[model samples]
Target: MFGGVTIGEFARLTHLSVRTLRRYHESGLLAPATVDPDSGYRYYTADQIPTAQVIHQLRELDVPLADVAKILATEDAEERAGLAGEHLRRLEAELARTRAAVLSLRRLLRPHDDTLRVELRKIAARTVAGIEDVVAQDDVLSWYDEAMAELDAAIESRPLGPPGGRYANELFTDGRGTVLVYRPVADPPVRGRVHPVHLPPSELAVVVHPGPHDDIGVTYGRLGAWVVDHALAVDGPVHETYLVGPRDTPDPAAWRTEIGWPVFRLAVTDVMPGKNPGQTGNPPP
Candidate 1:
């Protein structure tokens, strides 16, 4: 081996454990320059020190082993840099989410009035430009961003009202279902996935969920409890109005999402003998 160094000496030079170096060698991530077939000992050359250092830096960034292999296997400088750039972008997004979570936790730890204000309102039927799809739960966030972008690009004008979405219960309970996102617009131009459609009028038990959606589920639970207490629950999809959202402001505290649950007054006799009085007994999709 050129400028030969034993495995132990190489590990010391790289500031990595001998065991870790061995593991990396077995994974083909950082193989030594030479191996003694008789003694099963690994040897490294001084020239391989930079490679070891690069591998260590990548592992510190939590890049997957497979990705590390891909990066090392590519000899093109631009391709290697592109792979690292892509991973850095993912790390930035994860950091943003972590910061948002910390902010949400601070609010949850503080004491304040926990009361929820709900209103009963009739929403008139209206025509909208939108897109509908059966999206997997895991893909919802990215799908929503693309769908909204398409809608925004197609309209080329301000929407008449805040954007809204209809979520079928199966989307949550079964992990995959239909989702419709729309912007209220008059005579919107149909382009790409954007098309004109009419929404039905319905009475909704609505409540405002403030702050980042990280804890919006808590608001949903509170609203459901309020519906059951008021005997106004019904069978239908959930609706959401993004009054002030990520697109509106960077401050989580300024964000507002209106959660609407379908409801109708139930008579004493209308209550099923064995079923929940607040339930409409609509079958799940």
Candidate 2:
């Protein structure tokens, strides 16, 4: 005790509580300078003041206790900086998501009466020459770039139809993204690694998106609402028929994607089925 500082006095000087100091000792983060054998009392020297203050600053930055212990165990400057840099990137991504949510809420609250035009259309079957892949939703953008490059090399003539995306059942429920590119032509070859998928006949609730793909979620919500109002339910994954893409159109403002929700006629009857003797569809036990 160079400055005559006891454990309690040292905690006050370092802006740390007595309980916290004791916990740090147990965690091997910071240990006291001296300890009594028989009395079991703890004491600290003035030189340990800087160590206590450093721990205080680190805890204030939201660093986990385990990570703080690792930082103290290693003396490598580069490794410590690397950990901090990774945490900073995660914080930035979280902030961006929070900002996007705020903007969406603001858009919903604004007064507007721009009614969306709902159309029921039948899509004809056409041959497309492009690449297809199963991609994770988070990595879909990068996958699209690679697939487009393959399409450009495989196809001799330029794409006649728009670039589009096809979703499978697992896409929405499990976050699995399946994308397919289509080019219109007669008797397209289905050889090499390309797989041919036929477009099924069904009633589709179609809406034309007139801008970029940034806020496509807004259009999806509006279309679903329309389908609900008409007592129509979608039984399949949604499909986006891109009328314009980077290869066909240079201006993003002119880009168009025909978003279609597959739906069918609901058969309503005034008949009810008899309950089984042992099973009455009761709530689970």
Candidate 3:
């Protein structure tokens, strides 16, 4: 009203809708310079055009309404810039996630050979320095990192073999279960969460998964299918040997993980009923 402009005229001048102006007034983000008591009309001055434009720009960036209000209420120019910068960082993170998802989806849609080279191995039992916890699936990454750091610090010397872990089936199926990370040591010092534990020997159907772990599930699926086809799968926890992981190398292409599933040989009768070739009903010694 100071500039003799109605709400409609201000809306056109600011390139903002009347509805948005009404909302900004109600939200206390921007109030008109005057309101007619008799006609219940809203009026704005020329000074508010810049304020309305700023609000429109902030909202266009998808900034939350509360944050927008905070930015407007702040008197310090640096504080206002910081608030906007924080939201920009969040948007950048989201964009990164979107890019990763797109790459994964492209790989999934493109058909490629699912055949993986697998091996049968018998591992001997050994005592290892280890940590076990019931962890949620979402927290597994950070939990693993911390657990590995603890084990590295506790062990005085290098590991006897590659770092490995055992994951209970329920962990994958139920999204929360037991996970054990271990490093083999000749004589490991037991301190803190690190303790000496015996790992049992077992026959395993092992397969190597190369590259990053983002799509390792596809390799696991193929390996499980192989085990089922051979009728060698047993009810036991899955073992993982990190041959070349993030700690070993920064290049994901060079990473190699050995996935082991406990298995047992099928009996002759089970393989071919009533047609035995003098084979014993036990795994090869």
**lDDT for each candidate structure:** 0.84, 0.69, 0.85
TM-scores, all candidates, are 0.72, 0.56, 0.67
- Which TM-score value belongs to model 2? 0.56
Better of 1 and 2 by TM-score: 1
- The residue-by-residue lDDT of candidate 1 on 101-132, one tens digit each, is 77667656767454677777788888899899
How many clashes does each candidate structure show, in the order listed? 0, 1, 0
Two-way lDDT contest, 1 vs 2, winner: 1
TM-score of decoy 3: 0.67
In terms of TM-score, which candidate is strongest? 1
- Candidate 2, residue 34: Cα displacement in angstroms equals 35
Model 3, C-alpha of 161: deviation from truth (Å): 2.0
Number of backbone clashes in candidate 2 = 1
- The true-versus-predicted C-alpha distance at residue 131 of model 3, in Å, is 0.8
Give, for candidate 1, the lowest lDDT window spanning 10 residues.
276-285
